[model samples]
Target: MTATTTGGLPVALLLPGQGSQHPRMATGLYSGEAAEPEFAAAMDEVFTAMGAAGKPLRADWFAERPTVPVDHVTRSQPLIFAVDYALARLVMSRGVRPAALLGHSVGEMAAAVLAGVFTLPDATALVLDRVRRLADAPPGGMLAVAAAPGELEPYLGDDVVVGAVNAPRQTVLAGPEAPLEKTGQALRDALFTCRRVPSLTGFHSPMLEPACRGAEELFASVPVRAPRITIHSAYTAGPLTHGDVANPAYWARHPVAPVLFWPALDALLSTGDHILIETGPGDGLSRLARRHPRVRAGTSKVLPLRATEHGP
Candidate 1:
C-alpha cells in the first residue's frame, strides 16, 4: 500500500530476502536513468558467474510456463541482493535517504551493502561464496509454520529448530529433510498450517554449524569497513558496527541462528515515524511490517519497489 502522508523524512529502508528475486525484475526500472547501469552491471556479473546460458528465470515463468528450480539458495541469494541494491542506489540517486536500514535473512547482506558496511564487489563475492558453502553443506531443509513462537516450542524438542522468526505469529523450522517432513506433519496434525520452503538445505539452524566455522575463517581475511548509515542486525536484533564485521564467525553462525525479525523491526520503528521502503523483487517483508502494531498505528509506512503500481 502507498504510505500515508507522514510529517518527517523517510527514516527506514527495508530489504527483502531470497524468496523475492526474479529474473528481469528490473526491466521497468532499467528504463529509467538512475537504475539502468547498476541493473545491467549486476545482471551481467551474476549471469556470468552462474554460467546460465538461456534467459534468466522471471515471474512470468510461473504464470506463462511450468515452474523451474531457480529458487535454489545459491542463485536466489545474490539475485535478490542485486535487485534491492539497484533499487536502493536508484532511491539514493533521487535524493531519498533513510536514517536506518534492515534486511531479513540474506537481505541483511544487501542492507550491509546499502549502509556502506561493505563494497558491492566484496559483498557480491561474499554472497556467491556463501552460496557455494551452503550448497556443499549437509542435506537439510526449512519449513514455514503459522504458529506463534511459544506455540511452536513443543515441536522444537529434538529434531527441529527454529530458523526464522518472521513475525509474532510466523516461524520457520530447519533440520534434516526427513525431520522437516515429520515436523510439518506434526504441526499439521496439531492444526497449525505449515509449508515447505524451496531450498533443500536447512538454513539458520544448527545444520550450518560446520559452514559457520569456515565462514569465520573466510571473514578473517576479508576486510570489513564501516557502513555509511546504521544497519540493524537480524542475528542480534541490534545495530551492527564495523567491529562486528571482523568476526566472520558471527555471520557464519547467522544462517543457523534464529532470525529475530519482529524485534529488529520493533527497534527500527522506535526511531520515529518512517516511510519503510522495501527494496526488492518481492514484498514479503513489507507485508510483514504492515502487520506490526507500530506500522498499523500510523507510526510507520511500508513500501515495496515492485514494478506494478499496486502497493505492497
Candidate 2:
C-alpha cells in the first residue's frame, strides 16, 4: 500500500559499508524454518544467486568459527552485502516504503540493486568480481581520524589519501600498508586521535586504479536502469541521476572514488524531517546520523534494525 501521506515525516534507509561486520550476526533472523519468511526467502534468493559459493557463504555466515575471518574483503564484502540486502527486504516486507535510501561504499550496491539498477543475478556477478579484484589489490587499509578532512590532508602523502569524509570532524584515510602506517604514526605524533579500520584494503585510494579500470568492461556488460527508489549516493553526495547510473564510467570509477557520505546524508536529511533507519549489520551509520542537528533537536531519529525473531 502507498503511504498515507508524504506530508508526514518520512523514513530513509541507511546502509553501511565496510568496518561494520561481525560473525554470526543477526542469528535470530533464522529463528526457525517458518520464521520471518520474507527475510529467509530473500536470503535464499541472494545466496542462490551466488551460485556454487552459496553453500559456504551461508555456512560461514552462521558458523560459530568461520574458516575465514570476516575481516578479509573476500568474506566481509559479500557477506555484508548479503546481510544488508536481506535486511532491506525485511524492512520493506513490513509494509513500510521508505522515502529514500543512502548507502556507504559497498553498501551502495545493495541500494542500487533494491532500486532496480541491477538485477539479482547481475549484482551477484558484480559483487563476486568486486571481491576478487579487491582481494588481489595491494595490501592496504583505512584509518579513522577524529578530525576534519582538511586537518588530515597535510599528513596524506603520495600513497596515502583521504578515503571518506563521514562527518564534519570524522574522516577516513586509505592507502597501501607502508604509507598508511607511516601516515598514521605522523597523525599520532600530531596528537590526532586516529585508529585503523579493520580488514579493509584501500579500495578508495589511487592504488586501486588498475582494478577500477579493469571493472569498466564488466560494469558495462550488465543491463542498467533508472532506480525505482531514490538512492542518495555517497560517491556523488546526491541522488543518483539516470545519466549517472546508465554510464559505465560512473560504476567503474566507484572503486577509487572518495566517499562523501556526510554531504550525501546532509542532502538526504535537509529536505524535511526523516527518521534515518540503519538497515545494515551494526549501528555505525546510526551513530554518525545521531550527530546531525535534526536528530539532536528531536525532529528526527535514527533507528538501527536488528534481526528479531519476527522481523527486522
Candidate 3:
C-alpha cells in the first residue's frame, strides 16, 4: 500500500452504489479520448442481454424531477459499474493512481477490476449474473434509514436486516417490502427519517442466503487473482487478499451482509490524508466522505469524475 504524506494522508478511490447511476451516464464518454470501444461494446451486449437498450440519465436530473426511477437494482447496478469503470479508465489515462480502492455494494466489482482481481469481462459477467440472481429473488426490497446504526436495531426483526451502514447515521435496511415498510413506519414514528430504495427486491439480508450459495458456486468456477493495488473489502471492513478471492461464497454472501463503511473509511483514513475520488456518475460518495470528521478537517479531498469540456 502507498504510504500517506508527512501529514499521513492517503488517497482513495470511492465507488458509489446503485442509487448513483443515471440514464445516459456513459454517453459523455462515447467519444472521449479515453473511450474504449471494446468496453463500450461489452456494455452494449450486457444491456442487450438485460433487455435494456442504453444507459440511464445522470443522477443530476433527480434534483429537478421527482418521478425519475434511477433505483431499479438491475439498471442501477450495471450502469453504476459501467460509469465507474469509465471514470476509472479516464483517471488512469490521466495518470492518477489511488493508494487504495473501496466500493459500496455492486460498486465493489468495479473496484475489484481496478485492483486487478479480475478482468473487465469476468467482472462484468459476474456482476450481470449477480444482478440476475438478485432480481429473481423473493419479493423483498431495501429501505434507507436516517439514524445512527445502533439506533436502528430496535426496528430489525426476523424478516428485516441491516443491509448497509453507509455512514455515522445512514443505514440501509433490506427485507420483504411489506416488512421494510413496517420498519420504515416504525422509524418514522420514532421521529427518524426513512425512504424506500428503487427496486422492490431485498438485498444484503438473510433473504439472499440462497443467492450467496449460488454465487459461491459460480466463483469457484472462475479464477481469482491478487489485485495490483490495495483493495478494501466492504464485506470484511478491511483489505482483501488473493486468498480471500478464492471464496466465491464471500461474494455470494456479501449482498446479505451489512456494509461496514464507517470502519472501512476509518481504516483508509488511518493510512493518510489524500484525495478521495468518487468514480461514478453522482456525488453521493463524495458527499458521504465530506461528512467524516477527518475529511472535514481537510485531511482528504473528495472529487467526482464527470464529463469534461473535451468529454469524459
Q: In angstroms, how far off is 309's CA in candidate 3?
A: 9.5
Ranking by lDDT: 2, 3, 1
For 14-75, candidate 1 gives per-residue lDDT tens digits of 88775565544555555454445655555555445444421443333233342444466665
lDDT of 1 at 10: 61
Stretches off by above 4 angstroms in model 3 are 1-10, 31-70, 306-312
- Residue 196 lDDT in candidate 3: 78
Clashing pairs for predicted structure model 2, backbone only = none
Which prediction has the highest TM-score against the true structure?
2
Score candidate 3 by lDDT: 0.72
Candidate 3, 56-165: lDDT as tens digits:
32333223442444565566677778767666666665556678998888778889888888777677778877877877778888888888778887889967988888
Model 2: per-residue Cα lDDT at residue 149 = 83
RMSD of each: 4.0, 2.2, 4.8
Q: How accurate is candidate 2 locally (lDDT)?
A: 0.84
Task: Give the worst 10-residue stretch by lDDT in candidate 2.
Answer: 1-10
* TM-score for all models, in order of appearance: 0.85, 0.94, 0.84
lDDT of model 2, residue 59: 88
lDDT of 1 at 133: 81
lDDT score, candidate 1: 0.72
